[model samples]
Target: MGSINKTDLCWGDNYNLTEWYCNASNSIASKTYNCPYGCPYFAYACKKQNDVCVDSDGGKNWNVKGSITFANSTRTDHCSEISTGPVLVEYYCDDYGRIMEAYNTNCACNEGKCTDYFPICVDSDGGIDYFTGGQVTTSTSTIKDFCGNQLYNYTYESYCDDFGNANYKTYSCPNGPCSLVNGSGQCPSTTSTTGNVIYDLFKKVKIAGKVIQGIIS
Candidate 1:
C-alpha cells in the first residue's frame, strides 16, 4: 500500500467548521429556555447553576416566572419575570441600538404602573413644557382660596404634531363656562379683547410649532 499523507490535514476542531457549528446548534436546540420579556427575537444563553436557571446573554438575570420551553414542541412556556426594582432595570432601545431611555421600577409611585407615569418632555411657545396624564379632578372644597374663598377651574384638550408641542393656551376659571369669552382673530374684523385673545393664542401656537422644528433638527 502507498504511504498515506497526514501532513496537510488539520488535527483539531478547525478541520471542519461546519461540523462544529452543527453540533453547537444542536446542543443549544436540545436545552430548555426561559426567555426575556420582549420576545423570542432576543437570543438567550442559558445554563443551570445551583439548580436554578441563569442567562449568559447581556439581558440581566431574572427569575423564571412560569415554566420552560423546548425547541421542537409546538407549545412554549418562555415567559420570565424580571424584578426591575432590585434585581434588574428595564430600558428602551431604539432600532439603531441607541439607548433612548433608562428607568428603574424602584422610582414608581404605585409599584405596578411605573411606565404609565414616566414624565414626558414637551415643547411650547411659552417655554419648555412638561406634564403628566389625566386631569386632576378637584372638588368645590379643594378649589378654595387661602382666605376660605372659592376658585376657578376649566378643562379642555389640544393636539400637536409628532414633536411634543402645545396647540392652545390652557384655560381655567373660578366658576364655569360663564367665565369664558370666546372669539377668533381673523383680520379685517375690529380688534377686541376676544380678538386679542385668539390672535395671541394663534401666535403662541405658531411659535410652539417652530420650537418643535428646532428640537427635531
Candidate 2:
C-alpha cells in the first residue's frame, strides 16, 4: 500500500476553509481580507477599511483646530486657507504644513509711494520764499509808519526747507534802496538827492489826497 502524506488534510477537517485557504494562498491576505493574485476570492470584501476610517474622522485631517473668520467668509478645520484684514496678514505654511501668522504693517498707505519733506523760507513780513543757491531775497513795500507818506522797502534773505517752511534774515541797504543782484545786496554807486526830493514830494501829495478823501467820507 502507498504511504499517506502527513500534511494532507481530509475534506471533513474542522478548520474554516475560507480563512485558511485565503491566508495560505497569498502574503497579502494576512494584512487585508482581500486576497492577492491566484486566489479564488481576490478582491473579495476588499472595500478598503482604512478609507472608511479616514472618511469618518475627516475633520481630524485639518491641522488648525479653530474656526477661522476670513475677511469675507468663515471656514472650519481647513488647511492652507487664507484670510485678510484691514491690515495685511502674511501667512505661510511651515515645513510641517502648519499655518503660521505674521503682520505686515508695511502696507501701501500712499499707494506704495514715498516722498521727501522740503524746507521753505518765510520772511518776518509774512512773505514766503524758497532757497535755491547764492543769496535768495524777498522784498515787500510798505508805508513808513502808518502815515502813508513815504514808502519803505523791506528786504529779507529767503531760506526754505523741503517742507515749505520759510525762514528769512533781514537785509539792510547801506547806501540806497535794497536790491538783490546775483543773489547779493547791491548798493547804488551814487545817491541822487534830486531823486529823493522828487519821491518825497510825490509821497506827500498822495498822503494829502488820501487824508482829504477820508475827511470827506
Candidate 3:
C-alpha cells in the first residue's frame, strides 16, 4: 500500500462512485499518487464498505465499484465513475520494465505514441536531438563538407542514477548541427561549469562551431 490524499476519501464501494480515491504501497508509508487536480495522472477506485477507508491509489489491483444501494430503495447512488483526463505525461521504460524518463505534456508536446514513449526532435537541417528529464542526452549535427572531405560524426551523453547507472542521453557529429537521440549511454566524456542548461548547450555548440570553422577556413 502507498499513501492517500484528499482525493481518496470515499463513502461508497467500487460500484457506487464516491469521491476521488488512491492507494499506497504495502508498507503504507506515504501516498504515491502525487498528481494535482486537473493533471492527467493515474487514478484508482476506493472500494471499502466501512464508514471511512484509506485506499491504495498507487499500487496495482484497484477495484471499481458498480451499482450499489445505500440502506433502502429511497436512496440512490449519485456518485459517478471517475474518468481520467488527457495524456499529459510520457514515460520511457527499459527492457526490464523500469521507468527511465518522463516528460510532461506541456514541455514535451508529443501526442499519441510520443505521449507514452520517448521524444525525438529533428531540426530543419536534419540535425537531431534527444532528451529526457528536460535535459539533452544525444545530438546529431547537419552534414557538411570540410577540406574536400565529407565530415560526419555525432556526440553522445547520458545521465546516471545515484547508483551510477547511465539512463538517458544524445549523439551527433561531422555532418553539421547536432541532434538528439534517445536511450541510455555512457556519461558525457566532457564536463562544463555551472550554468543554465540551455546556455551550456549553446556554449558547447559555439565551441564546436569555432573548431569546425577554423578547420574549414
Candidate 4:
C-alpha cells in the first residue's frame, strides 16, 4: 500500500472569485463563497460564509482545532470584522468537516470580502462646465466641456490616464472677451509672433529698403 495523504488546508485566489480551489502555483489560499449576511468594516472586502460551515476567505482564516464539539447549526458558521483591524470572528470547519470552531483569527491579507462587485461611475467631462454625469454623484471622472461656464468661456486640456480616461485639470483664459467655436473656446489674440509678423507686415508694405534694413538692425 502507498503512503496516505494527510488532510490539507483549503486555498484559492482571493482577487478573482471565479477561482474556487488552490493549484500548485497558488497554494493555501481563500475559496470563493457567498453568505446571507455582510460584515462591512475591513480594509479589505468582508469575508463572508454561507449557512454552511465553509470559510470563503479562501481558507486564509481557517485553522486546525482538533478538539471541539461539532455544532449542528445553520448560519452559525460565519465570519465578521472585529473593530477596524485585520482580525475576523471566523467560523470554519475544524478538520472534521462539519465540526466548526470560532476564533478571533488574524489574517495577513483581506480580499473578496464585504461589498458586492459593481461598476463605479465615470464622467467624461472633468467638471460642471458641462452637465455630463447629470444628477449622479458617483462619477469617478467629471464630464467637462472645452469651455467653462458660458458666462466666461475658456477651454481646457487634461492628461489621459493609463486606461485612456481623461484626468481632471483647469485653465483660465486671457481674462477678456471669449467665445465658443465648434465646442472649443476661442479668445481674441492681442499679440503676434515676432519674426513672422514682422516679415509679413514689412515684406508687403512699400517701405524704403534702407529704412527696413535699419529698422530690423
Name the best candidate (by lDDT).
4
Error of 3 at 122 (Å): 2.9
Angstrom error at residue 11, model 4: 5.2
Over 95-137, each residue of candidate 3 has an lDDT whose tens digit, in order, gives 3222222323322122322224233332222222222112322
lDDT (tens digit, per residue) of candidate 4 on 1-217: 5543333232232222222345689553445443223211111232344323344432423432122222233233234555654433344443323433344433322331222222233433433332222221232644333444545433333334445445433333454433554554434444631111112111342244533421221
Candidate 2: stretches off by over 4 Å: 1-111, 115-154, 161-163, 179-217
Name the candidate, 1 or 2, with the larger lDDT value. 2
Q: TM-score: which candidate is best?
A: 4
User: lDDT of each model, Cα atoms only?
Assistant: 0.24, 0.28, 0.26, 0.34
Going through the candidates in the order shown, the clash numbers are: 3, 18, 52, 15
Between prediction 2 and prediction 3, which has the larger TM-score?
2
Return model 3's CA RMSD, one decimal. 18.0
In model 4, which runs have C-alpha deviations exceeding 4 angstroms?
A: 1-11, 14-144, 150-153, 158-163, 189-217
Number of clashing residue pairs, candidate 2: 18
Q: Candidate 4's error at 55, in angstroms?
A: 33
TM-scores vs. true structure, each candidate: 0.19, 0.18, 0.16, 0.21
Candidate 1 — which residues are off by over 4 angstroms? 1-40, 43-115, 122-217
